[model samples]
Target: MTSRSRPPRLRPLLLTVTLALALAAAGCGTEPAPDRVAGRSSSGDPAPDRAELEARASAAQIVAEHVWVTEAAGYALARQSVGVLGDDGFGSSYTAPDGGMLQLSVERRPHAEADCTDGSAAAGGSEPLWTCERDGEQWYRATESGHAYAREQGELVITVSGAREKVDRATLRSAARAAHRADDHELDQVLPPAGDASGRQPVERGDLPPMGDGAPNNDVGASG
Candidate 1:
């Protein structure tokens, strides 16, 4: 069978937006500049990683090009929740003050009108899709349990959803429309900070004998 039209994966897109959520617990993640990947410009201003902003995309496992983000009235991105969907697909959660939540995901997959009935429109076939409506470029689907807004952007399907009590149809629709590829600034806020690379240096231990190469500090002098 011939493959459907899907956008070629863009490389060097995210530096990887793990949503590194701790940076942003409030307000759609943190506004910290993209420090890790970017460098200072000639004007001394911090600039995006030359590779992301200036170079052409190449393939990688992160496939950060598929990562998308959105904005809603009171929802803030839960950076820690940002993660890969299936393979390189993007997924994240947005939270509100009342403990309400919204989920947004972008997948490199296909969904047509027929998929709605064949059960391919949702998580393989796990999500019960009972209601389907086409509104302009979006396809609104509702199951007995929940509802969501979905649209096909290139070869990817972007979706937004929330519990019925937490969010309304209009809100989900707005989120889906607002969803866009994470830009350099957003990537910085969304991607988790990287850990220091591995080295031979070992952590100093409190129990190790200071004078001996391999001995335990067993002296319990004063206290014992």
Candidate 2:
């Protein structure tokens, strides 16, 4: 004479809920991998290896190994100018307080010791009093007003250049000496995230004809 009511059908529903809850708990227990490009981090860590750099760079469609940074005595990095050069090369500029500019360029190309005269044409219109010398592994090239130090490390060519009027020769040399591949922290500070929507996008003009060579038609129509 035991009149035991059958267990409530709600038991099945309770079991399902419990299973889902367990799964969610399990998922929450596991931590996500740390993000290396999440802006400047306070943690002191060593620079990442080439394989890691390649992964990070590949995500941003650039060459990670090409990203180099240098510290000059009084020059500060121009954050806006830290950008990719041709294809996957790296280029950045530093500015001094007195309106001086120091440029750092890194590229993956075989660099043979060439006479400084070969690059003299880069000076510009007038011929500059050019002087070239070898300082250790660096090819130091100097004009009457400006100077640049370029060195080859493996498959990369790193150069530090500045105007003599503002940045001193010693400062430029110091920077070149310090130039090295960027670490994870530097990468975070220098490069914008891959496909960062927050970045400024190129403005789309309605007048642009999306045909031909895609050049803007400036053939002056009626209005000057």
Candidate 3:
């Protein structure tokens, strides 16, 4: 007599169990942590090298030339450059020991017209802006949180701002007046010309790495 055949379903059930166990074993293998990857950092990553910081400082200096500081005493400067969609710009911030801050930014657009008449006039007791006869070039001063000045010169637009109590209107005006177009050399340093190989340039300051909170001061202002 034939032995009672094991239930037909038993074979498929055993195969299913074996497959699931195999998958479970595979899942148990350790995965590389994200921080372990190159150019990546977990909370425990090491601080930037001295050379890197120095390079950034040098770049900042190139940008800071356009920013005029009335008094260099009791203040430290931090600067950064940004390039996007063929437009290039730089930003700088001067921070005083007493929590005072002044920010400046300059942007260059090849296609933009330097026209101030289109800008809405700032309101109510605000310092009047100065307009130049050339292409309606002008400066606008606003007293919101503090004092801010925006000016356009040819293809360059510059803006300066400072804390109301800490910085005076004249200082802002002076900075605006001091703003000048970045020369080709400075632009090349900040935004290297694209290489012919791929018609693309290497990554620039625009790719500034994320500096997490709790590091040094966050005194650098946002780019205009």
Model 3 global lDDT (CA atoms, 0 to 1):
0.39
* Model 2's TM-score against the true structure: 0.61
lDDT tens per residue, model 1, 73-120: 777776555655676687777776665566777878654423443333
Cα-based lDDT for every prediction: 0.57, 0.59, 0.39
**Best-to-worst ranking by TM-score:** 2, 1, 3
CA error at residue 94 for candidate 1, angstroms:
0.5
TM-score of each: 0.58, 0.61, 0.36
Q: Give the TM-score of candidate 1.
A: 0.58
RMSD of each candidate relative to the true structure: 12.2, 25.7, 28.9
Rank all candidate structures by their lDDT, best first, as comma-separated numbers: 2, 1, 3
lDDT tens readout by residue for model 2, 15-98: 323332342333421321133322234467666454654555666556766778777655666555555666667766666556
Any runs in candidate 2 off by more than 4 Å, and if so which?
A: 1-56, 112-114, 117-129, 194-218, 221-224
Stretches of candidate 1 off by over 4 Å are 1-46, 50-61, 113-129, 196-224
- In candidate 2, list every pair of residues with a backbone clash: none
lDDT of 2: 0.59
